[model samples]
Structures are given as structure tokens and as C-alpha cells.
Target: MKNTYITHALFMAMAASAFAVPSLAQETNAVADQADSGGLEEIVVSARRRNETVQDTPVAVTAISPSQLEASAALTIGDLQGAAPNVLITSAGTGAAAANISIRGIAFADIEKSFDPAVGVNIDGVYIGTSTGQMLDFFDIGSIEILRGPQGTLFGRNTIAGVVNIKRSRPTGEFGGKFEASYGSYDQMGLRGVLNVPVIKDVLAAKFFAFHNESDGYYKTVGTGQRRGGSNNENFGASFLFTPGDRFESLLTFDKQVQDFDPILGPLSRTGDAFAGALPAEFVDGNNTDNVYRVVAPSQQMVGTYSSPGVTNEMNLDLDVVKLTSVTAYRESDDQLRQDYSTTGLYFADRDQQYKQFSQELRASGKLFDGFDYVAGVYYFNSRYHIDQFTSVFFGAPTHQDTTGWSKSYAGFVDFNWEVMDKVRISGGGRYTYDKKKLQTAFTDPSNAGASFTGDKNSECWKKFTPKLGVDYRPNEDLMVYGSWSRGYRSGGFNGRGLTPFASALPYDPETVDAYEIGLKSEFFDRRLTLNLAAFYSDYQDIQQTTTVSVPGVALPQTIVSNAANAKIKGLEADFSAKPMDRLTVRGSVGYTDSKFKGFIVNQPVATGPTTSISRSFDFSAVDMIYAPKITASINAEYKLPLGPGDLKLNAGYRYLSRYDQQISADPALYPTALASAPTDIITVAQNDPRLRSDAQNLLDASVSYVFSLDNGLNYRLTGYVRNLLDDRGTNTSFVASNFPVYWGFATAREPRVFGVQLGVDF
Candidate 1:
């Protein structure tokens, strides 16, 4: 049945190709006119493994220039939500480490890759495999391109939801550089530099970029004595270009970047309820990092432990957590988690996941003949991580938790593209990848702690055959029509050791996807208007998913991973721009999605699905949260002005994100937990239970900037911005239940109103 569908899709595409000859000629002529008008500049894209015009490519894509990114201050993917509708990357917690990226409604609910993310995050063609890893910051980027829908055919590794292509600045033949520096509230400080140097005349040129940022923690650490919510980072890179005036050239580039982060402060019983008596007066929110737990009866607790004259506390809590984390276990009589207890809480424990990565990719591309173009490339990478995660209770009390293993992966992929015809195009590419990983406990045998089990659960496997194909036709001088079909996949790995026997990792299978898309790219109204639209349908098989639940008699929680569901995603995206005046331009986009489970049966002992009637995509019930209504849209208008000194440009914009849950959690019955005994009066929910669903909130953000140039060929820019302009508080809630409700808190309030200003100069 699937083969028949592919055949029909190809036949129709072939027919379209057959009739697009005249349109091709017309498009070429129209392109010539646009060149004269300076509106349709050549857009070089490698979506198919080779460079081509945006209109000549068959994929649905949106490209934002460096100026656009700077104007919006889109420092990360999540900030790109209102900047581009089809691309919605959001965060549940604080900082650049806890964001979830969703493309066309395909989001990765599991942060640990037991289940893969539909969309993949790539920086300079290097795959950022995990969901948390995707939360990294962006620096020294020349441009950003977001391809909506499935993208399996060309890129290797991920192509489930879509692709985010980040293109960094390369070496320039001319010697020049730009520098930006800023300081703001929260003791914020940042500096960045981009330099292009002429190394060997026209033969070799070199480019260098550097960034450093430091800030104080936003949330108080209280008695813990550790600062949380602050960002400490340092990044730098160098690229050497060797053109040597030949068809064969090589570009050698490398970068070293790290974010030394302060972990997010622990659970808040409620969102902004403000702690008075419920929280001890000596608790000293935000500055104390004492890990020793001490309970006080109203009579014995003293006032001002730090400032008071004579206050003898029972426990001194000598904490040295930057180096070690203490632990505590309680053998309670009842089930641990209860719905009524939290209302909705933030369980601040389980805080490990520090990432460090190194990657390399070498690509070469050139025009072949009168109607042919091609490209080929090799990729390699290595990453090591040392993480310390823990979940603890208030008053500096360490709860039952586990310190897990160090994780790692190594992989490679080869890709190529061919422009087979003048008017018609065909692209083919593939990748061979191998990934190995392990997870074990760092703590000794603790009678009442989860994740304290020993031995590494090691799994390693090879992934082969990831290919892509595409076709584009110019229906007329004004429109470029196209269609594409491709394949993409994510490597599989082991489940953490905390899971029960039957639910262990075992032999998990790699998940694969096939995507089909049709679209139009065009420019009209005499170079004043530009528009792009696309529709896509994708089929996913053996999709990976995970459920974290606790066993009744055990102190630790269980994590189950398997290929338990299949899914189908369908969506449409539109991008439009209008430049009415010479110095003024307006741009906006919208994305619509419809997705659901196709074939799913939870806890199946084997890989096969049971016989069942087929209906709409949403009929299958094994899915935890694939179906998402993520309606995102935005608009920005910039008007260039002529002020005193030189060319003065004024820019301002607004962005909005519709309500959508970050993850579709599993429900109790389908993915159930073992018997429970705890102290809380509430009921214990399963790990994957969707009922602990986090709330969805809308957000709005805006910014403005100005540019000024001097008489000596030098330029300067100043920008002021505000995030969460409306202060629309977004709630982030997660369900982390052990044998009981050991930890509880709501995700932090959405980022507050952040006001910032920057100054830059080019030399």
C-alpha cells in the first residue's frame, strides 16, 4: 500500500515536470528583470546538498538575513517563534538549557532521545542531537534558514519535524571586522567580534569570531549558598578559506565554545505566591547554598540566623555543592505522588545534564555543465559530558535521587546533489552513521534512592541509508512551483538503569520518516512584493517514545523506552513580504498543522502492531503528545530614514505565539505505574500520564534599533529591546513522581520584562 502511494506521487510529479518547460524559460526571463530591479537577488541554498536559488529548490523554506536576526534579537530558536510561524521553539524552564523545539507540530517529549525529535537542530551542518543541546545560543551567524516539514532525504540523522540550518560567517577577501558590546540589568555583560583577514591575497583568506558573556543569577539560592539562573559563557572560532583561484577549494574551520552554567534553582511550591512563613524566615531565599536539612518547631526556630545576635540552629548544613551533593532517604508508608497535593508544583531535583561537544564537516560544491550543478561532503564528530543532577526538598534537605552516568556518541554521514536537467532538477544523497552510548549510577548502594543502581547499560548500533530527492518547475515567469520527497532518521540508544525489568532498553529500533511536500516561491508587483507557500505530509514508523514512572515498593522511578507508536503529520506554511516604499518593508508568516497517532499500542512485548481498523490519523491511542495545535504568527515593519549624519534606519516589530502544550504526556491506564505507598493525600500518576499536562500561554515580544555611519568608511549601530513586553506569565509544569510526591513545584514564571541596549562598530 505504501509503495503504491509513492508511485502515484512520483507519477504526478513527473507529469508536472513534463509540462514546465515553457514556464522555466519564462522564469529565467523574469529573474533577469528582478536582477535589474535589485529585488530578486540570487539566494544560494544547500537544502539538497548543493547550492541553488531559493525558487529552484523543491523544499518549503524561510530564510532570515543577519540584519533581520539582529533587529529582532532572536538569540535562540525559542525566540524564533514569533519571528517565523512554522518554527516554534519554546522553553518550560529558565535559561538556554531547557527549551523544546517543535516544527510542524512534531516535538520531542522525551529530553533524553529515547524518543527522537521530529525536527533537527544543526549549526554549520553539525547535528545537535538532543533536545536540551538545541537550547544553545547563536553567535556570529550570517543567516538562518528554517525548512518546514519532514527532511529525511538530504540531511542525515534528524528529519522528522524539519530542519534549522544555521550558516556562520566565512572568511572574506577584504580585511574588515565588526564589534558589539553591551551591559544591562542583572549585572549583565556581553561582547562579540567578527573579523575577516586577507591571508594570501586572493588565494587564501581567514575569518575569526569571538563572544563572551557573564551575568548574575536571577533567582536567589536561599540557604543553599549557590547562585542559580546566572549565565557564564565563552565562545570563539576561526575559518581559513583556500580558494587559490580554482574549481577545487577547501575551507578549514574549527570552534571551541562552552557555557559554564549555574543550575536552575529548585521547586517553587506555587508560581509567584511569595514565601513568608511556609518558608522559614532564616531560609534566606537566593544566597544560601547549605545542603544540610534542618526542621524547626515554631518555638525553636530563631530570627535572622545570619544577622541575629544569638541564634543556635539545630543543623548547620555545611554545604560545598559546587563539588559534592548530599543525599537523604525516607521510607514512607504510602504512595508518593498525589494530584491534590501540588495543585501544580515544580520538583527542582534531578539537575544533571551538562553538555560539551566538538564537531567537523567538510563540503565542496561547483557548477558542472550547461544545466548541471553538484556537491559532496564528509562529516565527523565527538562529544563528552560530565553532569551532576539531583532532586532535593526545601530547608536544604536532599531527597531520594540518583547521580547517573556520563554520556557520549560518535557519527559520520556522506551527502551529494545533482542538477540533472536545466528546467527540471533531481537530487540524491545518503549517510552512514554509527552511535554508541551508556548510562550508569554514580552513587553507592543507597537503600531508598532511585537511579542509585550500578553498571552501565551500554548500547551501540549503525544507521545506514538516509537519502533525499526533489524537483522544481517554473510554472511561469512569476511563480516557481516545486515538490520534494525525502528520508530522515534518529539513532536509537539505551534506557536509564532506573527502569524495571520488562521495561528496560533491550534492543530498540531506529525510527524513520518519509516526507512529501509541494510549494510555490514567487516575487510580484514590480519587485515590491515577495511570497512563498508550501504544504507537506509526512509518515513516521517505529517512532521512539519513553515513560518515566515509579515502582510501588522501590524508592527510585522507572524509565521505559520503546518503539511503541506511529504518527502522521500534515501542515502548511506561508511567508509574505511587501516593500511599498524604497526604504520601507513589511514581513510576516503563518503555519497550520494537523497531526496524530497512526498505529500505536503501549507496552507491546514485541515490535509488531496488532491488526486494527484504519481511520483518521488521530485514531490511534498509543501516542502521548504528538498532536499539537501550535499556531504561531508574526509581523515586522522597518522604515529606513535619512537623518543628520548618514543613512539612518529605524526598526520595530511584534511577535505572538498561540497556546500549545510543550509535551503530550502519557495517561495512567495505557502506561501505568506499579503499586504505591506514600505520605501525600493525592494519587500517584504514571510517568507518561498526560493528565499532568502543563498549561499553555500566549506570549508577546518587540524591539527597535538605529544605525549610523561615519565619514571614514566606519559604521556604528545601537539597539534597544524588551522581552515579554506584556509580562504575560507563562507557566511550566512537569510530572516527576518517585515512589511518592518527593519533589513538587511549577515551572518558573515566563521571563520577566528584560530591557537591553547594545552598541556596535565596524572597522
Candidate 2:
């Protein structure tokens, strides 16, 4: 029966592909099937601002196709991590404010206010300007390509770890459209559409894509007047493709995305909830049910309860991106997220960030000789109106807002790929990037010893010329090995959110890294097995370490930001997939990462009391920031069974993350805030200890889907899936403190298991 289903699926997939072998995917990869031994085309990508096959290219890149995404119902960046090994996507709390994304285990540390990330993100050749941590909102993207190592050669600034490129679908000269509506448990509803129209025969084409999704949150926000936590999204995009006999080609695109999410207030107990991750003894009956924040009156002592959430967040995130590509491009990007994040249920202590960016890139790329591909381009990125604000909590719970920071960058580069030999691929690239940042703003009230946050408003600039060398060896159609070396750097700036003048006045040095990598990309068993394996070592200088500062008089507990330090990282990554038989497919990936600071010296910012000596308050610089265990393993399988109406698919997947503290330097001497007014020597926490081990449990997700094809061009599918089948306790805790004697705070856990059912039909 399974064989029958496989036979039918192959026939139908081929038939649906116009009865053609879809050499499109194969042609793009440019490798012959192991069994066929015939040459195939290489995958084409815009990794270097030009189109070339991933196999033929001379850099380390991993690409995930649309079908692969569909198979897993990947809607967020976290889902893509499964396909792209070593890419970690986690959240600080939940919602649109702090989505932490790290590539190559470079992102296992806590985030600071307005601090940049090691990994940068780009969409359609335009760079995203800010890292507010929780801003992962996207839909209808065609593909995602991750450049493993430093992308400073072609992509500049903050590409120390790598880069993530999101390529959206464009218009085709055909009249076709797809619409799907799905309904799942907890009132989950998802609707997505894709439409294409031919505006002119061979001159122009128009395409539109849109998606809407909503779901009940996994945890119930107890005592909230409204539904505690849930998810909602709306996204739309339009694109135009123009071509005149291939001599002149152009693409214009516009995209907009918005999201709404209500995160769960707190975490579950050590033993997880009976039905998954829930706060037991909370929200039992309808009205007046006892919840976490329920309060009871003395007169009614039997059941006293208050309906106030311990933590809550409500936010609106909107992103607008427009791009015009001819021989050049004018790219505009605006990402705005207004969040009311809080720990006290009330909307009074929200933190907010505003990101506005615009960029222009002009380039000319094409094939010169039969085997030579070249490109030269100029780039400019400007980010303004990067606003950061705090709720009343900053001012002894006093609200404050400031907008004195923005960044601008200019760069130019030339890159080319040459097939020197059929078996050897070489790529040479260089980029000269110069950036400047000027901050001019004032805070209403700093911490206890500060009045106006202004003198720290200084300006600094940097210039770097990064070059890259890469080579790919393809001994045969089924195997390839690649090597690359490159340099990456991130600029320096001030932390404006600090309260004391000294805390905000600190100066930081530029962070830089030189990386070397060797990798093997191969396919075995006639297109049935695909493997990507790599090992790398990086030497980092002036690394940007996130540390906290204590403001005795200010309202908030602490402030986090970047400081200079030396570090090193070494790791290995492997992704494997095998279709041993025609009907079964198995894919898995494992990553081993070791990142640590070599000479990290923390800067203590808390001022000693008026009665204390200067050395006691400001003369401490200790080594902090340590090893990250790294993300370990993930596996997914899909099996087909012959069913009465059609075929039934049994899909199961599991992902494991190693145990390690999300943030290090948690001891009294290092992460000292929790020990208010204590000596810096008292802090003792490190990066790889048990107190901070957030070794997330293996999340097992499985789904069963049945599909039926109608006589017309219509298909229907019904799927039932369980996320976190074991109802594991996913943790999200971190230690944040200033000096040893001040304050150290921790956050809540992750969302619990969710059982859902999805029904969909496409015509």
C-alpha cells in the first residue's frame, strides 16, 4: 500500500510539474543525480548580489526550498532553523519586541537595549537596521539562504557571524492563483493566497501574495480582562517583473506585514502542567476562578483573589519594504514595533523601539566569458528615527523616551565567480565599508545620581576593507567540498538608555573577527541523500559583550549594552537527509559550537554610595561572558501510506538543544546587580553552569495529513498535528544584574504544548 502511494505521488508530482523532471530544482543545483551520473544545473542565488548556482559558487551557503518549507508548515524564522543548521531563533518573553536570532551559536547571549546582533538580516538586497530582539514577522517568502560565515565581502557591517537573506516570490508571465484556508484547534485559522497576472505579453507581469494567520496562545494569561495570549498576522506583497528579450530586465516589489500576539504571563512549575505547560491552580472555573493574580478580600477569606497578571505584553509591528531593481536599485525599508512589555500586568512599564531605514544599491552583473560571472556595486544605508523609550519603570517607575541615535553606512564592492576548471570553482570578492554614528538626545531622568542624559551624546566612526577568498571542489556531480576565509566587523556606539552620566558616557571599541572554514556538500544515493558538513574557527577582537549597569536612583533594575573584549569560536555543523526508499524521507541535523571570551573584562557602572570610596563604585573590570554549549540536533521524517480516499502522510520531527545558560557572567562579581550594594567580587556565576542551564528538552512534533485530488485543478488536505507531544517544559530563564551587590533578575518559561487540527482546500 505504501508503495502504491509512492508510485502515485511520483506520477502526480511529475504530472503536476508538466510531466517534466522539474530539472528546475535540479538545474539550479547543477549536480547530476548519483544514480543518473548525468550533469545537472547548479542552484542559483543572489548571495553576492548576482545569480549563480550554490554548487558553482565559491562560498558557504545553505538554501531551503519552498516545498521543504511547505512540508513542515514553516511560518517563522524558528521553523527555518530546522532546515538551516546552527541558526538559533528564540524569544525574550514573547511578542514582537525581542526575537533573538543567532547564527552559528554566536547568539546565545542576552540582548541589551538597542545593541546590534552578531548575525544580520537582509530581505531583497536591503538590510534591516535594528535588533529589538522580538521582531520576527514575515510571510509568503519564497526562500531563505544562510551564508554560514562572515558575509563582509559582499554584505557589510555586523555580518561577523553571517547573514540571513529572505527572498520573496515574484511575478510570472502566467495567470495562476492559489488560495488556502485552514482551521485548527483552539480556533486556529490560517489563510494564504498567491496570484499572478500577465500585464503585457513579454514585457511585464504582476503578482500578488497575501497571508493571514491566527491561533490561541498555548498558555492562558490568568486574571486578564481579555484572552491572555494568542497570535494574529496579516501580510501582503505585490511584485512586477519586466523583461525585453533579456537585454533589459527589471523587478519591482513592495511588501507589508503586521502582527499581534499576546504572550503568556508566567511559566509553569518545575514538573510542567498536567495538560502541557500551564500554571496550575489558575483559571479553573469561569468568572471568579482563582488564577495567579486572583486576590481575595478579608471578609471573603475563603477564596480571596485579584485578577492582575504578573506580566503581559501587547504590541503592533508593521514592516514596509519597497525595492526597484534595474541596473541599480532604490530600496526603502521601515520597520516599526510599538510594544507595551511589562512584568506588572498593567500597561505602565512598556519598552519601545522604532526603526526607520533607507538604502540605495547600484550594480551591474552578468556573464562575461562563458565561465566567468562578475558583479560590481555601490551601496548606501541610512537609518534614522531609531527611537528607544521606557515606561514609568525607568523613573522609579517614571516613564521616559529618547531619540538621539541613528546609523549610516557607505560601501562598494566587486565580486566574481569563475569556473577555472570543470572541477574547481573560485570566487574572489572585496568590499570597502565606512560607517558613522552620531547620538544627540537627552533622557528626562537618569538613575539616582543623574539628571539629564545628554553629555554621552558623542559621535564615532570606522572604516574597514574586507576581502574574501573561496574555492569549491566538485570531484564529481554528486560531491563538493568548499573552503573560504573572510573578515567581519561591527561599529561602536554609546548606550543612551543609561541613567548615570558615567553609565551612558562609556566608550566602546569596534568589534572584529577573522574566520576560516572548510565544508563538504554532497548528495548520495541518486538524489536520495543530501549532506552539508562544515567546521570553522574564528579569532575575534574587541568583541561586543552585553553587560548590565546599575542605576541606584533610576527606576528600572538595570541597563544592558555592548562592551569591548576578546573572544574565540570553534564549531562543526552537519545536515543530512536520506530517502532510502521511494516512499520514506528522513532528514536530520546536528551542530557543535564552542564560543568563549578570551579577555573579556566587564565594566562596572554603578556609582559607589556617597559614603563609599571611588574604587568601590567605578574601579572594577572583571572577566565575564563564557562558553555556549551550542544547539545540538534535530530530525524529521515523513512517511506515506496508501489510504482509501488518497494518501495519508505521517510526519514526525524532534529537535534538541544542549544545556547551557542563555546568558553568562551571572556571579556576584560579574553579574552583580542582584546583590545590591555588594562588592563586585561577590558575583560568581559563569556561562556554562547548572544554575543557568536552559537545556531545552527535545520537542517532538508529529502530524498526519490526508490529501485528495479532484477532477478539476482543485485539491483538499486535512492535517492534525501536535507540537511538543511529550508536553515538555520549554524554559526561558536568564540572569541579568549590574554589579555583584545590586540587582539580578530572571524571566519566565516558554509556551506549552498545543494540539491542533488543520483543514485546507486549494483550487
- Work out the TM-score per prediction: 0.72, 0.78
Tens-digit lDDT string for candidate 1 (230-281): 5555555567777754433455565544454443423323212222235443
User: Which candidate number maximizes lDDT?
Assistant: 2
> What Cα-based lDDT does every candidate model obtain?
0.51, 0.56
lDDT of 2 by residue, 1-763 (tens): 2322332343333234421322221111112112222222245787776666665455667766654555555556656543566666666553243456666656534333345567777765555555442243343566678887777766535477788887666666765554455565556776666666678988888876656677764444444443444666555556777776544456777555455555343421121111222213332221211122222111110110101001111111112121223222232233333332322322233444445556666655667777787666677777654455554431244556565566788988877788899888788778898888766555665343355555546777888888888888889887888888888777676665555555565656667778889988887666667777899988877766655544445555355455545667789998776777656777788888777666444445434552232223332223223324466688888777778866788888888776655555434333234325455543322332233445456777888889776555455677777776776663454443344332323334544566666665443
Q: What is the lDDT of residue 612 in candidate 1?
A: 21
